[model samples]
Target: MTQHLHTQADLDRALGELTLRDPRLAPLLALTGMPALRRREPGFAGLASTICGQQLSTHAAAAIWARLSAAVTPLDAERIRRARTDRLGRLGLSAAKIRTLKAIAGEVMKGHLDLDELAGAPADEAHARLIALHGIGPWTADIYLLFCLGHGDAWPAGDLAVQEAIRIAFVLPTRPGTKETIALGDAWRPWRGAAAHLFWAYYKLAKAPGFAAAPALAPVEAGTEPATKPARNPNADRRSRPEAKPAASERLKRAKP
Candidate 1:
């Protein structure tokens, strides 16, 4: 197994090796050249932000948080805990999200969720604990580990942005789902999260040269998930999303026996 690649130098070396292995990855190599890996404090606030960002666009998430921070004067557990549901809702949170925030705050305040212990726990253990909460899911936990905790080997397999970026880069016939992205990204290994960041950055850069970005999605509630979608580009996009409009998750649903 690969040990966690710590430090910016390790990421730099791995990216360099991959690009050299395949000249095709030149753009990725350029965009992510020795990027400063963001390291953040792992705690209730970080995890909560991860949950808030799920399925929402970056602009939308940021806006909501700005509003939320202002709404709750102190912006801590007690403030969120005592907040009325309507108050949170007014800040652009959905009914589901209100419960999620409340649960997280409650758990932390009640001493059920331990931010310090979680920081040191194994990835799997941390993931499991997060999922036990009311609204935390795999994608949310994965992102927390990847960006907030700065876990070297974390991957948000279900992130839409990763799928879309991979599609655009490789120019495939269809959009790659979580499972598909995971398989294709297997070669990236321990540096996959950084790979994800590079792909996201590339998505932004790719849209710069008159390539239309994906349609503007409606503003999501304050704390929501967002998956990024990239428009087709020949130099990139090894695969394509099966349908023109990415299939809606619930719309693709089935009954459980």
Candidate 2:
């Protein structure tokens, strides 16, 4: 049976098991406190929201999502499939995103992708099914599983923030790439989603101005940078990076359907 972190208690329980499984993470939990369970609506709206937030800052993504949500009545797959590309463009979606959303809507309508059922599927299987759809990548699929469906084992190995946090916490010489990150997550097993939450919390705290390094770990240098830049995504918007802030329009230009 698949585990789901659908509530705060569920996440806390997973964190407990995770800390016991990997004692190194205990210090991280101590420093970060209990990470909150952040969830989105399930199904089409949830997945669509994740798509809108891709490669954009929190404010930018939220702004566009607000526009899209307000403009589209109901915001269901049927409505999205029927909506014109131009109309969606005026709502701040890039041409590529518009195509992607429509394609997803079509898939949902055809009953080829069952978003709700994915919550019950094994993490790897769910991830595979989601990525099989047009415009859905590893990051997007894992984000949906972890945040939307609350799958306990869904690990977002491609997330730059998680990669950086792991590098810092493990005191690695360099940030791990996606494949390396995925391999590193093997030990975490079913609690990888909880680990992702912990790492994201750690990343935020570590990135705060004048934040002192934890005594349990090596001192993080002031203004320290990741050892490598994130690899660019040609098919979709790159995930948000701490060092780079390209205009959303520029990112859209690079995104292909």
What lDDT does each candidate get? 0.61, 0.79
lDDT of 1 by residue, 117-175 (tens): 75565444566677778998878877887767765556666777677766666554466
User: Which window of 10 residues has the lowest lDDT sum in candidate 2?
Assistant: 248-257
How does model 2 score by TM-score?
0.83
Model 1 — which ten-residue stretch has the worst lDDT?
Answer: 215-224
Total clashes for model 2: 0
Model 2 per-residue lDDT tens digits across residues 26-66: 78888899999989988999999999988999999999999
Q: Model 1, which residues run further than 4 Å from truth?
A: 1-14, 17-27, 31-41, 122-125, 210-257
**After superposition, which runs of candidate 2 have C-alpha atoms over 4 Å from their true positions?**
218-257
Instruction: Report the number of the highest-TM-score candidate.
Output: 2
Cα error, residue 172 of model 2, in Å, equals 0.9
Q: Model 2 residue 148 lDDT?
A: 94
